[model samples]
Target: MPRRSGGLRSGTHYKLRIKSRDKGAHNIAKQLQDFKKEDIVMIRTIANCHSGMPNSRFLGKQGKIVGKKGRCYAVSVLDGSKAKIVVAHPVHLQKLGGLAVQISKTNEGVV
Candidate 1:
């Protein structure tokens, strides 16, 4: 069967699955990689990452997709505790679900 882009499915909930070459795409925040611009993703919550640097202030939170800024993705997160916009890389995401909001085909000039 052909692959579908939007809506819900039984397989991966991400926009796209990472290939073998994309394994290391999600290792750390600094060495983060993969994922294209505007790609909606789900970042795994850092449970035990509450100390030092940015993590010291904002850990254990699920970030939201806003957009990208340079190599880092601008994220707006609300861990059910606090909400803020932070810059993160693709490696920080695990592709849990699709964006609740999808771009309209008409807006994209599709017919």
Candidate 2:
């Protein structure tokens, strides 16, 4: 058997750090943000909240909101030519343009 090595977030020490002043301060509004279907959203990781985070490589990638999964949202993004859905918490999603988008129906699920 092969020995286990690095974990999924092994090299993301800097990518997941919160500012000193913002440490331990939870943004209640963001944590309870509401995202509508077809809206555009950006994936930004919140170090304080470790739940439902997408892959680090997907950080800063923008995608369309497909649906909701529990308290998280389903975001559809393009990985090369293939489309991928990344499920993340609302705190990690920043709505783009602060407006709802009108698009076709999408598969109702999150990663």
Candidate 3:
């Protein structure tokens, strides 16, 4: 037997399937959503679209938008003790709240 090796979405058949209730035409609003630098966003993979899709490991992880590359946005996420950047489309990202407050609070006690 041989071990398998591949990038992010190597074995995500069931993990990224769309539910019945969510089955329908894609939302134009979501496809056209815009994100600014420093915005906190949660990665939500769109199963059908693979262009600019981040790794499945990063799915549901919150990251800060750093900049834009072509039509995709560069996002910085903390993976374990290291920081990593991934390029993803807006359709796979959902805005999240309270990140600024949380960051500030975490920094307050640090000398």
Candidate 4:
């Protein structure tokens, strides 16, 4: 497949550092640390997909979000096929906890 202008590279997308979600002089950082071990999360899409699929599809897949090279979430979207997707950050995704896939990532605001 050809490289899309904004598409992510396989290896380049797997070197991101997880952001610190903490409160000064508190144990909140420890709680946030546990979230990283989660295998899957529910999130929504903040970017436009040129694929022409419905918006629900992006939010409905059980993709793996890993901290990649660019500090992007290497999302493995499972829509009939497995796509190694990369999002700029994980915080962009809204954690649904149980059975709701509605993660959202910011494509313009942050780097």
Candidate 5:
């Protein structure tokens, strides 16, 4: 017998399931969203969309838009003390307007 290896989507059953009411075609508007650098965005997995989805660990985390890679945006998120860049599609991200946005605005001149 061999030990099983876990893959990216192996344990993401609950983290990536779509709701009953929202299980149809994906919204085009979401796919067309644009994020400028410093904008804060929340990572939300849309189970139906796997093309440009980020890792499951990044789900529910907020990150700042650093740049764009191909059709996805590079989001800078702090995992513990280290910062990691997560490239994700716009459909899996929801723009947030709150203290996170203010923090990014204030730190604009620091870096």
Candidate 6:
């Protein structure tokens, strides 16, 4: 037997599964959502759609939008002390509110 190499979705069944009640049709608004540069957004991987999907580690993490690459957007997220950029489709991203203010405040030593 040999050790298995963990991939992008190595251990994320529960985290990405959609509830039966919530599983019907994909929302058009979500699929066509638009984001602007510098916008704070959360990485939410689509369960079935793997196109332009980011790494599983970035799931549920918040990041700032850098730019748009075709139908996908470039998001910059801080993993520990390093800043990494991830390209993901709009369906895999959700706009987050208010958390940006708190993050800036903490960085400025105001909180």
In candidate 3, stretches whose alpha carbon ends up further than 4 angstroms from where it belongs are 2-8, 99-111
lDDT of model 5, residue 32: 97
Candidate 2 residues lying further than 4 Å off, grouped into runs, are: 1-4, 98-111
The most accurate candidate by TM-score is 5
- The sequence of per-residue lDDT tens digits that candidate 3 reaches over residues 1-111 is 997898666888887999988787878898899988878788899887777888898888877788999989998887875778989988899988776538734743331
TM-score of every prediction relative to native = 0.38, 0.80, 0.82, 0.36, 0.88, 0.83
RMSD of each: 14.3, 5.1, 3.2, 13.6, 2.4, 3.0
lDDT of 2: 0.81
Candidates' lDDT values, in order?
A: 0.46, 0.81, 0.81, 0.40, 0.87, 0.83
Q: Clashes per prediction?
A: 0, 0, 0, 11, 0, 0
lDDT string for model 1 (1-111, tens) is 997665322343342344566554334643455555444455543322322113323333444457777766776655444556767555455443433334322222221
Tell me the tens digit of each residue's lDDT in model 5 across 2-109: 988799898888888888999999999999998898788999989898889999999998878899999999998877667899999999999999787787677654
Q: What TM-score does candidate 1 reach? A: 0.38
Ranked by lDDT, the better of candidates 1 and 4 is 1
Which is the better candidate, 3 or 5, if ranked by lDDT?
A: 5
The candidate, 4 or 6, that scores higher on TM-score is 6
Q: Which candidate leads in lDDT?
A: 5
Clash number for model 6? 0
Worst 10 residues of 5 by lDDT: 102-111
Candidate with better lDDT, 1 vs 5: 5
Q: Stretches of candidate 1 above 4 Å error?
A: 1-40, 44-60, 79-82, 98-111
